[model samples]
Target chain A: MNYEVHNWGLNVGNVEITGVASSSIFLIGDNETIKLTSFYDTPPDSYIVGSLVPLRHPTIEEGTDNG
Target chain B: MDKRVAHIGKTRINSIAYSSMFEIGDANTFTPTSRVIAVQKEGGVETDEGFEFDQYELFSQEPSNVPDSLTVQQKNYHHNPNIHVENIDVKGISASSIAQLGSLNHIDSVSRIKHIRILEKEQNQNDLIE
Candidate 1:
């Protein structure tokens, strides 16, 4: 698959992915920030790749399920 | 109402508090220096990186009540294309830093469907007609 994002994707614990093609990387928390460079052939190819590393909020229990 | 009486002296209020009271500098002086992650500022200082989790936790029972104007996601896209983020070094960033960023009112949502495999199985099942 060209693009694949697994579970808890966006804003899930500061994990970031960067780069393109084989050069891309998945940066976990405490990892280095990844920067990408543009390719001349594909003018629009230049872009950073990653979702916002979200801070996981503790699960909130419903006082009344209403079920 | 005598101009001469008022012109007795032009005493300059040099104190920092006085300077802040008037529109001497940017009005930002009255606002806290903590940079809410999404908010912009004149200075290059990281404004949004200053909120600690303890300060910005949204679901806390007592103090963590959601703000009256909390940001919400208006659109939900499932398993959509991914967008890249810059200026964040995983090693350089901390959970607290992320918490600070969350304090800023931005809706970041990831839309994905669950139980797809189970749903597919259910779709294939059929009851034989009597």
Candidate 2:
């Protein structure tokens, strides 16, 4: 199944697809989206994962990996 | 710090362990036949703990009291996580309800709905609330 999540406020968008239940694709930053797939199998009990690509400022990046 | 965790390409979750873990200080309401999370581990109903809701008990509270069409969401926060709030299960919940809850953090949505149903269910078992 394909799910398209649109935010009413933030321009951020998320698209999740089944079949590969392991990871999900997310769009972060302006014009520069980030895709986190199979990044972390077992999410940490309480810790930050994932990082911002390059072009965008590090602050505008995400922390968690599991979707 | 509100967090956002999503599958890079896939929208579905991998494990059921990290289901819904809503934090306190969220928006939620309840009414007769109106479903809401009944039980919370830390915060009260005033604050949204992102608690998951139990559907069976929600409807059972007043099965005859027809369900109403409503919308419930969390208040805006400076730091919000990319939470996935959707009822994966084909629960008795109406589609609109799911969508409303789906807009917020995954954990909060579930807790808000499931918690109440769970409480009501237990009440029924003990003959507490009719």
Candidate 3:
């Protein structure tokens, strides 16, 4: 395979982002590879009336590896 | 990638995650993993078989919902990137996330989160009585 190379002036004005969350990334220069995985389970039945959420405590053994 | 002058007027990041990264130059590899499981109900959701950390599950088996891209897999990737930016503003980086300003070689991130909320319109359950 044959490839040609060209270099040109790269310019940008402004960048605005609200959030980079939950295993997300914000890069500014250059990268080779990026792999991001996210799993969200917010059931519709769970979201009710108000904005309050009563979190539960997981019941695990003392010696269990909670990694 | 070509080398050139990189300029930025301002950069602001509100927050970073408990397990996250913020780099300014360059990185070889980045691998971050996050796992979160939540359940809310009178007791709990039940089925014939339970789920595990190393396994995959769903409340109901829906083929369209859970796609193949979301599934865990091992693959190879290649990239050729270059950028010039100014005034970057980010809100937050959470759940094993990364924020870079220069250049990166490779990045692999994983996040597993599960949230289930089950509540009645009227609050009924209590600690001492129902």
Candidate 4:
């Protein structure tokens, strides 16, 4: 594997990203071989409480009323 | 790899999911495998039941080095993987996500994401029928 990546002159303005999720890649230009693997298990508070799914928080204190 | 001149303005990406990619130009191979099990439940419930648990068997196995990055052996490469981005404003790119502008040779993208959110708790009922 021998190479040259002379990716020249890239102008940019205002690249705002809220999210690029999981196995993510944002390439502007030039690539040979790229591989990405991501496994995300959100463990803020792992709660797997079943039995007709009953766990609410008063609609987030009655603000959004998110159903 | 040779690429030149990429101009971008006001490129706002709100969301790009799973095997996510937002490319402008020039690509040979981009293998993406994104797995996310996000569970945020404070006041939102929309079924999926946590995918019946088991923690996804840790990405459903199949990780023995992926053939050692496709049996790495290639040289004397050529590049035209082009890109000319002037202006782009994206809102959402979902699942097997890829939003390209120009130039691609061979690409293999893989996306597997499972987001489960279910919130409920506070049931106090006492003898009522009306």
Q: What is the interface RMSD of each candidate, in Å?
A: 23.9, 21.4, 9.4, 10.4
- Which residue pairs overlap in candidate 3's backbone? A46-B117
CA shift at A21, candidate 3, in angstroms? 2.1
What is the per-residue lDDT of model 2 for residues A1-67, given as tens digits with 9 covering 90 to 100? 3333443433224433332122221113211112221111121322445532324334544874524
Winning model by lDDT = 3
> What tens-digit string does per-residue lDDT give for candidate 1 at A17-51?
22112112222121112222111111121243653
Chain B TM-score for each model?
0.15, 0.16, 0.54, 0.45
Candidate 4 lDDT tens digits, A1-67: 5433344334454454444444444555444555545444454334545344445644367566576
Quote the positional error of residue A67 for candidate 2 in Å. 41
Question: Whole-model Cα lDDT per candidate?
Answer: 0.23, 0.28, 0.65, 0.52
DockQ, 0 to 1 scale, candidate 4: 0.08
The segments of candidate 4 whose C-alpha lies over 4 angstroms from its true place after superposition are A1-67, B1-19, B43-54, B61-88, B94-96, B122-130
Candidate 2, B33-70: lDDT as tens digits: 22333343333346554543432444334223436636
Q: What is the lDDT of residue B75 in candidate 3?
A: 30
Q: What's the iRMSD of model 2?
A: 21.4
The DockQ of each candidate is 0.02, 0.02, 0.27, 0.08
- The model with the greatest DockQ is 3
Error of 4 at B122 (Å): 8.4
Per-candidate fnat, comma-separated: 0.01, 0.00, 0.65, 0.06
Which 10-residue window of candidate 2 chain B scores lowest in summed lDDT?
B94-103
Per-residue lDDT value at B73 in model 3: 40
- Candidate 4 similarity to native, TM-score: 0.36
The predictions' CA RMSDs to the true structure, in order, are 28.1, 22.5, 14.1, 12.3
DockQ of 2: 0.02
